[model samples]
Target: MNHWLMKTEPDELGIDDFAHEPQRDFMWDGVRNYQARNFMRSMQPGDHVVLYHSSCKHIGTAGIVKVTRAAYADPEQFNPDSAYYDPKSSATEPRWDAVDLCFVDKFPRIIPLSELKTLSALADCALVRKGNRLSVMPLSANEYKAILATTNR
Candidate 1:
């Protein structure tokens, strides 16, 4: 199965929020970037995802999410009043896509980016890459294993 990393602001929907959800699942929406949209398009059911909490203290990977639904049109993209609206995107040719995700696990202590910088195995991970700001990215098998190993789980 494909491995992926999805980052969200803790204030928006972090690990604790996911864990507290009734079904532990939700549509991962509001991504408006083209590259991020393409990554969602590539996601598939059962794909393992690293749920990272970004734009918060010690931004880094926090937990795991399972892709429960593949790419589908993001309804918010069509609403002009929505914060994620894309004027160029149409219902027939949507410019955005999103996937449903199910919370699977969380690290006891956050595997912060400060610590991730020391791992040679994750040297190529997009999350660790300099100037990288995409909300969603792919993770290599080795990088995924190495990062998870460092977490308390």
Candidate 2:
């Protein structure tokens, strides 16, 4: 299965919110960037995801999420009153998409961005790259493991 990291603003949606939500799954929506939309379109059910909390005091992968549903038109994009509404996206020809993510577990503590930036192996990680802003991006198995390695350290 493909691996990925999906970012969410903590104030908007965070690991704590997922843990409290019924079934711990939420429809990831409102992505506006073309690259982020394209990445969602490539996802599949049963894939793994690193749920990262971004634009917060501690930006990092805070939990795990299993892709429960693949690509679908982002409902937010079609709502006229929605802050993420895109007038250009039609029901028949959507310009945005999102996936369903079921929260698996929350790490005891966050693996902070500062820490990620210091990891030699993660030097090539897009998550830590300068000006990197895609909300969703692919991750390799080794990268997944390397991040998880922090949980036990």
Candidate 3:
């Protein structure tokens, strides 16, 4: 299955929030970028995900999630009251999508971005690249393993 890294602000919805959900899952929404939306479109049920905490006190991969559902039009896009609402988007031709992610496990502790940058194996990781800020990004199996390896130690 494809591996992906999805960033979320901990104050909004962190790994713990997902775990507390009745279904232990939540719809990943509010993605406005085309590239990030496309990443969600490409996802499939059973795909693995690294839930990274971004724009927080401790930015890093905080936990794992399993894609429980594939892409569908983001409900938030149609709600005028929602911050993610898109007036240009119509139900007939929506401009955004979302996916359902189920919590897998939170890391023993955050694998800090500073630490990731120091790892040669993750040098090429988009998350580590300067000025790269796409919330959703792809990861090679080895890259996924390398990050997890840090938590094991």
Candidate 4:
């Protein structure tokens, strides 16, 4: 299975939301960026994901999640009342996709972005790369493990 990192505003669906209802499969959606949407479409069941909290006072890697279902057309994209609705999309042709992810772990404390930037193993990671802002990003095994290792420190 592949590894991925997805960023979310804490107020939206953050890691705590997963921890609160660990058994529920949350639909990860509302990704408007083409690159991020493509990455979501590439995810498969059992893939691991790093949950990053952004646009908040304590921006950092919050925890881990596992993909329980692969990509499917995002239902919000067809609902005009939904914030993620796409006027150009239709039932026959979807312009966005979403995956199902369930909680895996929530770190005792957030791994701050400052700390993540210092890890040599993540030097090539887009999450730490300067100005690289795709909400959904791929991660190498080494990179994934490196981030998880930080939880013990």
Top candidate by lDDT: 4
Query: Per-residue lDDT for 6 in model 4?
Result: 96
lDDT tens readout by residue for model 3, 1-153: 999999999999998897776366688889999999998999999999999999989999898999999999999999999999999999999999999999888899999999989888888888999999899998999899998998987
lDDT of 4 by residue, 101-145 (tens): 999999989999999999999998989988888899999999999
TM-scores of all predicted structures: 0.95, 0.94, 0.96, 0.97
Best-performing candidate as measured by TM-score = 4
Model 3: residues with Cα > 4 Å off, grouped in runs: none
Q: Cα RMSD to native, each candidate? A: 1.4, 1.2, 1.1, 0.8
Instruction: Assess each prediction's global lDDT (C-alpha) against the native.
Output: 0.87, 0.86, 0.91, 0.94
Instruction: Please give the clash total of every predicted structure, in order.
Output: 0, 0, 0, 0
Model 2 TM-score, 2 decimals: 0.94
| Clashing pairs for predicted structure model 3, backbone only | none
Which runs of model 1 end up more than 4 angstroms from their true locations? none
Clashes of 2: 0
* TM-score pick, better of 1 and 4: 4
Q: List the pairs of residues colliding in candidate 1.
A: none
